[model samples]
Target: MSPEPLQTGRRRRFQEWPNYRWAVLGLTMAGIASTSFPITVLSASLPVIADDLQTSESAVSWVQTAPLIAMAVGTPIAGKFGDLYGHRRLYLWGYALATGFTVLTGLSWNVGALVAMRTLGSFIGAATLPASMAIIMTVFARRERALALGYWSAVTALSPAIGVAFGGFMVDAFGWRTIFFIQAVPSLIALLAAIPLLPDTARKPEVRFDVAGAVSLGLAVTGLLMAINRGPEWGWGHPLVVAGLAVSPVALVVFAAVERQTADPLFPLEFLARRGFVIPNLVTFLGHMAYMGTLVVAPFMLERSFGITEVSRISAALIARPVGFSVGAWYAGRVESRLGGRAIMIVGALTMSVALAATGASILAGWLAGVIALLFVAGVGQGAIRTPAVAGVANSVDDADLGVATGSLQMIGHIGAATGITIMITVLGPSESSERFFAIFLLAAAIASASAFSARWSPGLGTARSAGAGRRSRW
Candidate 1:
């Protein structure tokens, strides 16, 4: 079927049901929450899993590492696939695959099996994000996109928080395996709901998949992520680290060359060169780097500097960040039409920078309430920036390129997060000193400040609004 007809059918359905967009958003959120549940749960259950499987902590950690690598490698390719085939089709398949793998993970007898299953699940689950974003952007008008994306961001922030809060209890009560089993229930529900709720995009049968480009790009991303993830564990000079560092650049070069030569490129280099597209992604990259980097060090800083030893209290403090995030996201969405994405992003980034700086001062002053307050403020900034950044990227691209554009944005954001965490680890360096914690926050502040500059170039000023109108006319 032609895309026009498929889209017409979807539009008619929506016209028939005024509230169908809400149903789409709800289903998408369910898929996202279910897929992300295991991330935090597995982290909390790592020690128990290691004891049960008779493995070391470092070895068990691969359960997390493998999935991170897989998701990073697969995300862009999955997005392109959605563009070629159909977002709805890819999303449904992703949920099915994730559900199956979740069950298999529950049944795993050893760490190796668990890692393999979880990695496969995450690889497939990565497809849902770009597909969901594309759907939401398509269904909502440009003016309302930021508001919709705000809800998406809130769910993204909340899922892990919910998982972290209840994960340890579940692990202790039942077992690590039971968590996977429980996760499968929600995934299955999402899969079934998606069947009727989600609409398919028009497939491009004539567009060829860039198999060689996918392979090379996957290898490049995997190598880089592996180097960052394992570099600290294995000395930076280790043969594996050296090889990964060397291979990634070579593979990236090969991928770039392949993209230039291919008739139908996986990532259109021309689209990447657009100021609107590139700048929003760069802002997202830097913003996430600062957010995740600070997050990595905050718990330890709380324990050492403020003498908060209880896990519950520390969790409560951490919860403040996400709450602030939810509030900021919703507020940004409500006000984006008046403020503009660029202005909103600049304000958000500066807010985060100020919060991070305040956090450092609070730690030095040994003020616990001040630390929590600062983190909450930082979360608000993080939440506010995400919606506009995402909407800006979505609006900058054509409808067909929406999947790949959003997917690449997410891929870069994840890479930034990995880089941020790695830098924080390197700075902290086997020490629990106040000075190192202060240094980490200061570095995060610098990164956040840089994001404000990046936001200045964001296409959000006028380009996105006009582009969105053009896209709507076509639909």
Candidate 2:
């Protein structure tokens, strides 16, 4: 063979630049963590916010609800749009909007304005979620995909912890609004960093935007989430709850019909129908349900069953979960290439199942140490499952569909978390008994076990295929 051309060698070396991918990942992680600050801070500062605005707690709660609904609706739309347009452009726009909105949120004069501004900001910021993932998938080859996802998972799992700690300090020092100001700083930094570091994906100009499908899907998701969130407060049988439940299904049906008629559907039914795509997402939903349900129920169980009333102690015990999550996520990424995504997910799910079961046993036996340890194990399992599951879903889809596919998976997972919390709360009921706590944990365990079984059907179950080759596999 003739000697390799010098220009070709230089091009190959440039393509293999190690710092570029890491820089992209770092910027995206900062953006993700910064955006999440509002959620945790808002939850912590609710009492202060309500008092400052001279509003009832219920009314002030809308600040959180508005963003939650906006995120759920906006995520898929952003993902699909990014797929059609360019993800880099959408990402930059998202950060700019987020930074501006955070500043506006800090300056809000009333509850209603705060809610509206936060909702708009979150809706725009939601674009960054899918766009960042799409960029990571495009830049990193298959061998490194799981590791990149692992770091992504770790940052996500760790962000709430960081937010809570810093938010509490800011709320105490400068008041609730200061947290928003703090949030804006990082977002501005991420936006500036992304401008120069992020790579642009080729735009599919031929793909038509499905306005009807987007609207229908957004309405459907909003209705369903609203019903779930308000069911306990309004009573599941309340007229509004019943109406919301009814509307969601009707909207979903309309969305399906609209998608069928669209030239470039927001959600491709054929893609969703595939076993590779569907099964991993199913596992994700089940796993998050179990994880979130247990997390919400644990503090109550600790206070009532173990009588651990100290806020610091409770916080310390809860903190272990995220710690475990960070460790497990990092480790999963390191080993995924060797063990494969399916195996890692299966193991992760089973670990969570065991942790849930142990939690139940610990509560029943009145073992505080056991409860804390089990909580950590559950967190680890949750983290492990997430990294592989996300990577698996990304690997299963074509390059064009990466954004929407990942967005849909995250949407399903959030729905699962909401559903899980609702169901667990119902199980706890108007009681403070160990028996009820045990029941909740056992139910979570069952859900976790089911998630493990579902992992069996993930694409490339035992194979060690590279990213490029994985994309060519049968649906």
Top-TM-score structure, candidate number? 1
Give lDDT tens digits, candidate 2, residues 1-475: 2111134444345446768788778878888988875565567578789999999999887887778778888988899888999898888888787789989999999999999998999899889899999999888876788899899889888887777666676677889888888888888887776665677786899878999999899989988988987798679999878888999999999999998888789998886656667777899899988998888777788899998886446666787788788878988988998888888889999999999998998899999999989898999998998888778777777878888988888788878887888889888877888988988999999999999999887764313464533344455
- Tell me the tens digit of each residue's lDDT in model 1 across 1-475: 2212244465567546778787788889878988775565576567789999999999999998898888888888898999999898888787788789889999998989988998998899889889888888777776778888888888877787787678767877898888888888988887876776677676898999999999999989988989998998888998988888999999999999999999999998876667767777888889989998888777788888778887657766787787788778878877887778889999999999999988988888878889899899999998888888888878777878888888998889888988998888788877878877888899999999999988887656323345553223220
Worst 10 residues of 2 by lDDT: 1-10
Candidate 2, pairs of clashing residues: none
How does residue 88 of candidate 2 score in lDDT? Answer: 82
TM-score of each: 0.94, 0.92
Error of 1 at 1 (Å): 20
Error in Å for residue 71 of model 2? 1.3
Error of 2 at 78 (Å): 0.5
List candidate 1 segments past 4 Å from native.
1-15, 461-465, 468-475
